[model samples]
Target: MFSRIDRYRWSFQDSHLPEVTLFAGENVAFDQRAVRELRQMLEVQGTMNRWSSHAPEAFPEGAGLQKVVLTPDFHKAKGIPVGTVVQTRGFLLPQAVGNDVGCGMRLHTTSLTAEQVLGHQKALIPKLRRMFFEAGRNIPMNRLQREALLREGLLGLMDTTPRSLQEGLWQLFHDQDLTHEAEHTESLGSRRARNTLGLEDFLGQRDFTRDGQIGSLGGGNHFVEIQRVKNILHPGIAHAWGLRKDQVVVMVHSGSVSVGYTCASMIREHLSRLYPAGLVHPRNQLYPVPNAEVHEETVLQNWDALNAGCNFATANRLMLALMVRAVFQDLEMPTDFPLLYDATHNMIWEEDGTYIHRKGATPARGFEAMQNTPFRFTGEPVLVPGSMGTSSFVLAGLGLREALSSASHGAGRVLSRGQAMQGSTQDLDDLLRQHRVVTPVDFARTRPDVAREKLKELLQEAPDAYKNIQAIMETLQGAQIAQPVAELEPLITVKG
Candidate 1:
């Protein structure tokens, strides 16, 4: 369905459909149906035609899909490919952004070396399991703090002083690190929560209490991994980014947990209600909310919900990093885990009057776009993690406008979770043992029933479930979308 335009690019051109550009190698395959569904989102029958003459004003001039680009990890997902990047004028497609509003990658450079972390593995693994899986996530936030997080994310939390819990986990925050954290975080890791829908329980309280979802490493591919810098692909950028050979760093892959899904569901329901009566629904079931006067309230509410959900997600990652710090503290190791960069791959960005929706795609802006941040000299740090038992890469965004300044989020899933579960469990065990990956469960100590369930989860996320990350990196570099700075090998991995 696509013609190879170059070694790393493919173009699907149709006179009646919007042109799509896919960035991948021959080894990567695309779901034909996903490409068709993507085309449907841009055509007359797909979206604009669904609006009734009952509301002609809703159909504005020059309002439709504008551009589409897929990263190397392009694969089938609900409605669109996982690595799809689409830009639209005068409208927003929440489905393109997906349920995980601010789900993204966060990287931290630590002072310890791989030898230091690995040396403590014997005593460290159980503590990690206890803290991450058991009742050890003790992050307590008052209603005000939660409200600030919802309102302005990390910036809001930094501005507000916690009146309770000045010791222990709360000590992770310091005035000196506050501004530095914001400076390194993508977009300051804040979004204005204009509307707080379905979040009543998380707001309006003066007392500090712990919530289950805030500091959690949610299921699926989400994880907290301690990695060692395995190789330095670009020594100049690696040194500039404070990455050294064999240095230990923490990589967190997570999102807003239930908070993000709740907001996404609300937006979807709102769109469903606004859809014109007696019209055929979009074939892919993907809906778009127009940015028009008639739909002003709906649009505003959506933006607010998106911002709030994203705020929660950013806070969730920060809390998770602190939890990791707590582990280091108990081990009497250095707990200063300075954030290298925190960025969201799944979100919407308004650029030059166009909404760029990225699902499992990272914002890879060049030095010019990042002039205000510390990374202005080197460009944005793109954190692309691999599947379990693989090496992750730290790349610098080249910010090529041709690709909408985007890159892949991970070595995109090759197999569905169901398909991955069908893989051999013994293979997963061997890989875990070989790679020295530490999961939350101790299969030998756990009950057979519980072990089986945990093993299922493990098998679903096995490294074999994903494409070759080395190939993905090659495609990325060959396409000139991003340049690899350093490669990291996982030393200890904590999965929920």
Candidate 2:
């Protein structure tokens, strides 16, 4: 099913798996292990190409699938491939969206320069330690406020937030209407999601704390970094985004916290029971909820629950960014950290009247498609963050139709977390010293041993665990899906 196409791309076709389109296949070196796993998944019943006559009338549109695109950052994940974009006509697949519902990136530009932060590293590092590790007490919000943000996202919380916090937000976004900030965020940062699982089931019996995961950084490749725009590739787009060379920015990579996981688990369990016993595949547990087979009430309930998870994730990222902003305010730095854009990679989106499941791919709608957005002239700002200690990119979408209006999320993982920890000769202290990144683990005042162990786990997320960022960038530009606007280098990195 897998064969060579060209120097840069590869094509995969099978009787079961959806047609695969991969970019930079030669450069990144496709892992056959992951491809075999994908094939096992496709062989399952009710998938894109494996539906049987005896199966429920799931795909009324006859498979209801268009294509599956793998971005340049394409690589192996556990059951599904990361950097995958699946387009379906009338069916929605839960596995395609993966576990993280609203996993995404948020960029904020500040008036402060990289030099200022670096110079004050000693004073700033300890402050950051307290802010992230001290139970996030610095972020001004009560249980009710957290619930409002989760239910209604940034817009709902903006109104309910304390006056001081609201003022701080306004100070950051002086020009743009604070109420309309959701327009800049993907999916408007909120959806009409309801609590389908009921309050007790969703919260779990032992977990009584409200918004316990709101401002958390979360583990596994999630981080908040202080970066400087090293260079501007497209001057006009950079200017439009209010980004300048050498300017300081905060880039957050996180997701929906525990809310998304719970939602996914609930949906999966519901569908698993309904799946035909004969059609179930051992290697693949992915269940597709076809629009035709599902009752209208069930559909609405599922969407509401999914939207709630997505909204929670979107709000969680914002809250984390706000926490960073609070730190900057305390440090007497530029508190005017206006949001440049917020985009999620792990999601299922309805675009151009079709459902697209982007596991680790960013939506790259073209200028014409986004004519109503503030960046219609330049297309959406697709923020592609690099692995830790590497150069992240801000790119303008070219909106290539064949590519499903999507691009890579990051340098896709070359090594899993477990693989990264084995046969490692790199020194953690030297690596951080070279990158000049500050973390709470670095300043463990009381538990130095525990901090050191935490630091070792972080080392597993090193740039070496992922594909080359330069190659991924070149592939996107070569494919004409997205063009780089600016490159950002990290200075301070905070990981959970």
Candidate 3:
């Protein structure tokens, strides 16, 4: 099954760099651009294989890279492929995780049905706007509460923060027992992240506006969507996960926002100075902090900062979900919002003693690997969301060793944002009307030219900019990496 074909051949032969592996299903053509990028990565050092492989000269020397794996959604990113998974033995690559340190997806199953939300659409939007916008005044958090949440994650927030400050958020935190929700969240929404580097001092020197960002959804593909479970592919697992057909679920796709970017920039700057002079490539903005070269203290500092960022991201998603709950409360609807799972696709994890960097890829540990959690019988839930106005999936991991137990985070971008903006001739109103996706943008109030440009920006994120999600999901299932459990169709999408 793994026989080499002309299409799978590497562009250049190198003895030192490991051979690039392609995992597309039979009859499926791999992305040529990604293949070329991988080939360029092999030629860059001739010693260490780069992850992105786009601009070989940009990568620094002696990266200590061990392996590079591309998912079915592989596509060209700034320097690396969006669906690329990079493994390193004794080094940490900043760019591998990208600027969004803990950018990820979170889903909460609600007692409210699709009918309730769709019926209340007229009243729901105003309340949602009040909770999401208006300075995030609905969900208030003090400096101390913000620090605790950042330092400790969801568990920390529950244990330390005052319950009186934000009753809605507090109620949401205790909606289900911490242990139950923690089992669903990656790293339990916080791994008791210790800050030894005084991130507080650094954050203070910067803009340092944690309260405002907590419940706010960041832009560029980030959204809080109301979706309906259209179909249950695996009935048993769906039942076990408390999901049913026609049930409403709130899905939040966001990240650490400015907090994460700030931490990543700081870490990148520190690591950049340590790069060997000639090793620094102008095109390669990524730098790896190898354990061998850097002092133990510096390594610890970087790790601490990264952990802090990850914790902040986890809390940020939780806060965003809580904000959604607040909207539900304001509308006096079914208030039970039990968390299904929270997982990060853009981050690094220490698995089996090797650091695996997953950029736009979800960790799909199978049943055996999740013995301690409720998913012991079923694998961890792998959420693969689609572009706006499309179907999203909930999958169970198969833990394919060849694919590093990872799946694509979303439908990989086929066209760049700029390209989509330039080429898009989509009729925004008609498209939305066709899909019945309610957005906050009031097209009627805006000027015609400005509205057209805004519509282009919206079209840039339309389904056309992405690869066929059905194809991507099929590729994952064909490769035995994950199997779809449930399919969700978006009813209402809230974007920044």
Q: How close is candidate 1 to the true structure, as a TM-score?
A: 0.96
Indicate the TM-score of model 3: 0.88
Model 2's TM-score against the true structure:
0.90
- Give lDDT tens digits, candidate 2, residues 423-472: 34346656776776556565435486776676668767877788888888
In model 2, the clashing pairs are 256-313
TM-score leaderboard ranking:
1, 2, 3
Q: Report the C-alpha lDDT of model 3 over 1-496, residue by residue, as the tens digit.
A: 1244343222224456644455555444456676566555434333234332543443345445667777767777766777888877656665677788889999999888888887888787766765675554344455555666667777776776554544446666656567777778987878555562545642332222445566768888888888999999999999999999999999999998878887787787777665556543634455556554324555666776677778888878887887777777767785577889999998888886678988888999899989888789999899999987899999999888777888889887877788877654456567665665544455656588877766877777877788878877788887788989999999888777
Q: What is the lDDT of residue 291 in candidate 3?
A: 59
- TM-score of every model? 0.96, 0.90, 0.88
Off by over 4 Å in 1: 29-33, 36-45, 50-54
- TM-score-best of 1 and 2: 1
Please report how far candidate 1 places residue 456 from its true position, in Å: 2.1
Candidate 3, 407: how far from true, in Å? 0.5
Superior by lDDT: candidate 1 or candidate 3:
1
